[model samples]
Target: MLVLILGGITFSHAQTKSDSLAIRQAALDYIESQHQPDSAQMARCLHPRLVKRTFWKYPRQQREYLRESHADEMVLLAASYNIKGDKFPPNPRKEVILLDVSSNTASVKLYADEWIDYMHLVKLNNEWKIVNVLWQFKDANRHQ
Candidate 1:
């Protein structure tokens, strides 16, 4: 009985780790797909109501919302860089440090470049949706 209990616990932990990995990879893929990547591909990975957060020098919190229709934004992004036929990187190395999930809510810590970033996600129906993100990038060059 004890052995069975231990095995069950281990299985649960493994499943959680797998789920976290999937979410982390999906997030990275979504970000890369924004660089002349397909909208359909983005629609598969990103939440319709994703929110990006940043804090200004005055301590004012700024938020950008990704609504259902992001075609205009995608066009602008492409035009700015003049990347008409650039394909996204095939593989992005995504590292997930932590994931805490409860029912429909999940909190995750992920390593991108400078350090780990935190996000709150919610599972809506059959979809894992990112509801809030807390991250700040110094500059685009810093991301490189």
Candidate 2:
């Protein structure tokens, strides 16, 4: 009986990790998609009402960047990221998912040698979209 109980607990934890991975994967895909030149390419994974709140390395706090419609916001974010895009086009997304997930929300900890990054995601219209990205970017190298 004890063995069975322990197995169940382990299974639950694994399930949580798996779900969190999915949420985090969505966020990563969105970031990579930003590499594309056009906002339309980035729109696939982003929520129409994605609220972009960034954290600067100096003063640690969530600050309002922009909150707008899908098309407008995507353009703004892509431009800010400095994604010159490519002559080709966006291909199938490539990203890694490592995060903690819950029913309505998720927090993804993007691991890197330099600084830490935490992406907060929310379930909107039954789809996972990154609502907030809080990170202390160490260098100019893009986190994606």
Candidate 3:
């Protein structure tokens, strides 16, 4: 009985570690895809209905507004945003922090070159997909 219990605990611990790795990978994929300007890679980690939101104020506008970007737009951005390779500083930052993970759901905080994104991911069909992201400019004054 003791051996069986230990084996079960070991299996559970390994499964949790596996989930953590996958969650972290999904977050990395989301950021690196854009850094690499690979639309296909960006598309892979995003759910079809992914919704990315931000709070922003246009120069000509008076009040801050809620801005949203869908998966299609994100994919297009990944394709063109960094094509010139000058969009970001040399040796840009790309950090992924796995905030939490529970069975089929996970949350991540991604620190990218120009912004920070809080992402929510879900496991579907045995794969992790980013479903939502709330982001803001790293330097509040910088808007791209």
Candidate 4:
């Protein structure tokens, strides 16, 4: 019985690690699909009910504003570059950090060249999808 319990614990740990890796991959796919203008991959990584919000700073006016975007809009934006035949830089500076994970829910932070995004994800039907995002531009003068 003791051996069986130990085996179960080990299996549980392995499952958690596997889930974490899948979550990370989902987050990476979200970012890469957008950067690459790959609509299919973007759709795969994003939930149908995704809501993305961004805080924009108007330095000239010394004010900030909130902007909201839905999943459809995001997919359209991701594909916009493709429509225009625009090319992105070969190597863009980006980072994805897994913040937390609990069962079917997770949070991740993505640092891109111009902005930082906090993404909320959920495991749906055995697939991880980004459900929400809160982002802001990287301000050099801002204090941490």
Candidates' TM-scores? 0.53, 0.51, 0.84, 0.76
Clashing pairs in 2: none
Q: How many backbone overlaps does candidate 2 show? A: 0
Which model is ahead, 2 or 3, in terms of TM-score?
3
| Candidate 4 C-alpha RMSD relative to the actual structure | 5.6
lDDT value for model 1 = 0.54
The TM-score between candidate 4 and the true structure equals: 0.76
Number of the top candidate by lDDT? 3
Q: Candidate 2: global Cα-lDDT? A: 0.55
TM-score of 1: 0.53
Worst 10 residues of 3 by lDDT: 7-16
Ranking by lDDT: 3, 4, 2, 1
lDDT by residue for model 3 (1-144), tens: 998888776222223777888888888888877777999999889999999998877777656788899999999998998898878787878889888777788889999877899999999998899999999887977653
Q: In candidate 2, what are the lDDT values of residues 28-49, reduced to their tens digit?
A: 5655545554455466556656
Model 1 over residues 23-72: C-alpha lDDT tens digits? 66656544555554455555555565666554434224333343232434
Instruction: State which candidate, 2 or 4, has the greater TM-score.
Output: 4
Model 3, position 49: C-alpha lDDT score: 98
